[model samples]
Target: MALPVASPVVIRFGRLGDTVLLAPLLRKLHQRYGTPCRLVSLGECARTLYQGSADVAQVHWFASQHGWLWTNPRRLAVALALRSMREAPFYICEPDVRTRTKVRPMLALAGIAAEHCVFIEDIPLGEGEHWADWLLRFADLTPAAFAATPALDASRQLRAPSIRATPDELAEARAWLAAQGVDAAQPLVLLQPANKRTMRWNGVRAADDDDKSWPVSRWAKLASAILQWQPDAHVLLCGCAAEAGYLASIRAEAGLPRLLAPTGGLPLGLLRGLMELAHSMVSVDTGPAHLAAATGCPLVVLFGHRWPSMWVPRSASGSAVTVLGGLPHTPRVDQIGVEEVAQAWWRLPPRPVDIVPAAMGERRARVA
Candidate 1:
């Protein structure tokens, strides 16, 4: 049976990886409904990544303050939802458990009955299933149907995750690279070494933060090794603008002053452009790895203790996005060696053409 094609909405909020991982679920929605969707998302960066999606019709950005519901009522969320989807018999999919509690109440306030909403808890949580697969389940897709869908393209995204930039944005990124002494002709290897690895709970022991990060020292070593292996390779160290000092420390620690550093405030769209142009990427489990994968960039993703089968980016056929993990059962990021990572770097095919030259090509390159 054909699902409704009009005014379907998906509500999701989390870090960049969570947004990127929504690719498969979004594709399933489009396949079932045969139309793009409206998205209710949070954060400017996540909004930037999904706003122009071919599978998503519109994105409603929700800003949550750090105070009482009275000051920022739950009604605000319902208004945001209704603004995108009115009384037109809409479908709502909420994938995150964290948001489920709040979203249910918001929908009730908007007078949406129970049947209209889809929650993760409603679906049977499969053991060791990838979250993307879990999302398909939440959408009521059968396993066989899930397998039949074009997962590679879908995992790339309903539209491939891109940092579509205007001419000025492209020039700005190129100029920054040039100023950092990056050779336009050489292979650019991007290094994303830092992440928001910890979040506090109850002002006590940090929860949901484990060893997903490779140390800065490890990153420095890996950067130096990459330089040694590819002498002409231009290395760009990337992080959120707030991590400028941290990125600098890695460069300083590696003692590679010529390493390119974009300003911390570089827009996410421009950053995606830079990723698309790069020869390859090396990072711990971070959002940029997933973004790089979307661009068809060869990547070596290091997992400290995270499950690669569950969390690694969707890669295309012949994708060099290698996943290196620690011992089975007890993964440790620090346990992974520089030599092991360097081997993965060596496995990547030679760098393709610099994207700066083909700056105006199709935003999503069909990864062959």
Candidate 2:
């Protein structure tokens, strides 16, 4: 008889972009162990990410206040929220030191046995190791395992993150795009101009960190150039609701009045479906860029704050080009120029003929 399968719990509490980076790790787990494991996360995007995901058994949302885990009610709340996973083995994937401190106490409170959990802190990531590699190592898996995992050999995993969208969601995206005057004939270029992590209020950023958002001025210039290069291209802005203000600023700054801004809000699933329809996406270092990569949409990503070695967006095969910050540790978006991004877009394999809207008839028929 086969031994009982272990039902592991995965813990990752990073926001949108971090969650996108986590995709490959989850895929490998699903390949190794066929069942979906429980995932614990704090990101709103996590729910949508794993909704139909074969890798996720269920998602537990844990809300913790800004104060330390040692505090009263906040600690108790976290403990209660995670009480369900007390009996299962946990794969703790959060890397930040502060998160590590909080996770241990929560596990103890939730009645989880100490031996049943594996923390990233147990075997800290080595110097220069990619985050995904760090995760595979955390699982005590061999390097050969990583090599054997399809789309993970070498750096192929970078382009291999995957997400599934429902038929209803695809219909909604197409309907919404049709309403917005986006047609199948022209190339749809998604321009994600907003980076919420770095935006400031009263000149104070939420965290004094840099996630590398390309400046709006440069984005406008790039938008103008894309239009010049691909005359039939339609530039559509995309981001979470929080980044609306910043997106509007880019729109005004770019002076492209014809840019399509879909009416009302677009949910994560709808946005993902739209990504599949897009010809190419040009994004600053952000979450939507990752979603685009999962759809295998041709992408050009601009990286400034984080090193590409640490957080470059991955896509299957050669679907993405990462432009890193030229300056040392504190590089600004200006470090990358519009010409370089346009050049990267130029290099993408001419959009495959079968993926074109005209050839998308079969998919559309299925949805119909």
Candidate 3:
């Protein structure tokens, strides 16, 4: 069945990983509906993450969800813009009850009928299905608010989520790495030692905060281990400029020349670009760790009690990914040891020959 000529709209407030996961549904919808989607996303990265992709028609982004319904002018403006496209079918991916409450009135204010919207909370997910798969399946679910919803795109099955980085973006990444004196001839190993909360607090610990971080000292130790086995390996400490001092301190703690921290953090596009060529990445569970998985970079990711499988970003590209934590026994990522992480990295399967550059090969390459 074909959709109406109206462009589809999707609502998801997501980070790099979420956006990466969102790609498949967008791809399916774009193919089925024959139009790109208008995305209502949150924060700086969601907008940045989809810059190179054709699936997103326009990105309506705001700083944060704080006071979004009343005080956020950007949110208000987006509602007004959607008012003009009132006929377009809107898919609400957010499952939070409070969020739905805020969204309902805003859409009503824009003169959108309840029948025109689809919400994911309408039903329970099938057993052992990935959230991305659940999202793909939920689009076809007709909301009780609407009579018979148009059968959404389900013909095209996305094996895994994939984000496309532009060729120009790849070139820029190479230039940036080369400028950083990153010798592309040798293996480029990335250590994404910081997650959003870790960087947000500048690695600080506070009461009532959820944490999924490996110790910086462990990160420092991991860097040394990489150089110990693979002397020529360039271990890039990944973080934003705000986390520069923190990453630098890790580099200093490691006390090794191979470990280098970029003065600037790896931006979303550049990070994707580099991941395509990177030998591997090791990190605590975070959005970029998901991004690495999507890009097909071999990964060793630490985890916590949260997101046993639902939030786990399995490699869409079928890249090797090693997970090291979960519920019952391993409550926090910090409980995972440095030696285990190092051994996991050692155990990661080699990058498939097709994705490898001419100069890129085995991880055991050593400097003379």
Candidate 4:
């Protein structure tokens, strides 16, 4: 018998990393309802998170509204589109109360009934609470359904496939590196010195605390250390063009060879593909860290204020060492010193030979 068609459920999550973290809950919703669920996302980043996922039937970009009614025709068009679809049960998934309060009225104005909405707030749990499991509770799933073990197991299978770089792209990248006398085949370590705009803490004004970023100097130190371990190991610095000058400064101070920032000027898809080819990735709590997780690349994630339990990758094999020693939700990377991050890197197990190599040579690559 066909399952009863309920109102369409819509999830409103803005950030890319948050959406990735919420994948398990979305999966559970799809399993339970087996209905076409729509996602109302904020921008390009959120759209990328849902890419290649079976859970989301369609994604609508949320536009700014001037009044209670959607002044933006695009939003009205989306509402009309939703109305055109079957009048299934509609649900708004919000894990935070503040966001729920802010978006609830807006959703209501868009015609979502209050009764159909659900909020999953900060509920207490015993030791080793899996947040993904906790999120399923809002959907009427039992504790068994909320179990993390199965979720983690499923994550392993759903890991994103490596973005395959075309021959022309590879040739161009290699030729550019070669012209600069950089070894194209050597093991390369990519360092992302900056987090996404939303994740960075601008610093506290109390105690005369000065604003700072996770020191670029620390990355220079790590790059030198990696090269000491493997003399052929080259360092590539990657980020937006605005970050290129910082990379240049770091390169000059460290006096190390610098490869082109693949992230600069490249489309999001291409950059992700190049990241898949790296030996290992080290990033502060950011979008690149989440992207690295999707590639199944071994990652050393430095955390200051965020809860690692709630945000860390689900794969057991993919290790995350978070230096969270402060009040919850207040991630201060300054509190996490260079030595602490170094220790985390030291603790990371050596990359398995079965994993993808920095240079895609004759070696057989592992299934990502």
Best by TM-score: 3
> Tens-digit lDDT track for model 3 on 93-118?
88788877767767877898777788
Which segments of model 1 are wrong by more than 4 Å? 1-5, 65-68, 73-98, 141-172, 198-210, 263-265, 316-318, 326-330, 350-368
On lDDT, the leading prediction is 3
**Every candidate's lDDT:** 0.63, 0.66, 0.75, 0.54
TM-score of 3: 0.89
Write model 4 residue lDDT over 1-368, tens digit each, in one string: 13344524555654555555555556656665665456765556555556656676667765543344356676555555554433354555565666656455555555654444455553444345555455555545223222331222343332322322344444655665566466656655667776554222342123223222566566677767766655666667766655656666566667765434443544445445555556566776766666666655567776655566655644323433333333365456666665666666556554455445445543213212
Candidate 3 collision pairs: none
Candidate structures ordered by lDDT, highest first? 3, 2, 1, 4
By summed lDDT, which 10 consecutive residues of candidate 2 come out lowest?
A: 142-151
Q: Per-residue lDDT for 87 in model 1?
A: 30
Candidate 4's C-alpha runs over 4 A off are 1-8, 63-80, 122-131, 141-184, 197-212, 262-267, 316-331, 337-340, 350-368
Q: Rank the candidates by TM-score, best first.
A: 3, 2, 1, 4
Clash count, candidate 2: 5
| Candidate 4 vs. true structure, TM-score | 0.71
Judged by lDDT against the true structure, how good is candidate 3? 0.75
- Cα lDDT of model 1 by residue, 1-368, tens digit: 13243445677755677777776566667666567766666566656776556676666665672344346654376454564343323444455465566565556655664544455665765766767677766655322312433323334333233333445555766776777777566667888876566223332122235576566688888888888876777788887776777677778889875566656645677777677567788887888788777666778888876677677776432345788883365386667788888888877764343432374233223211
| lDDT of model number 1 | 0.63
Better of 3 and 4 by TM-score: 3
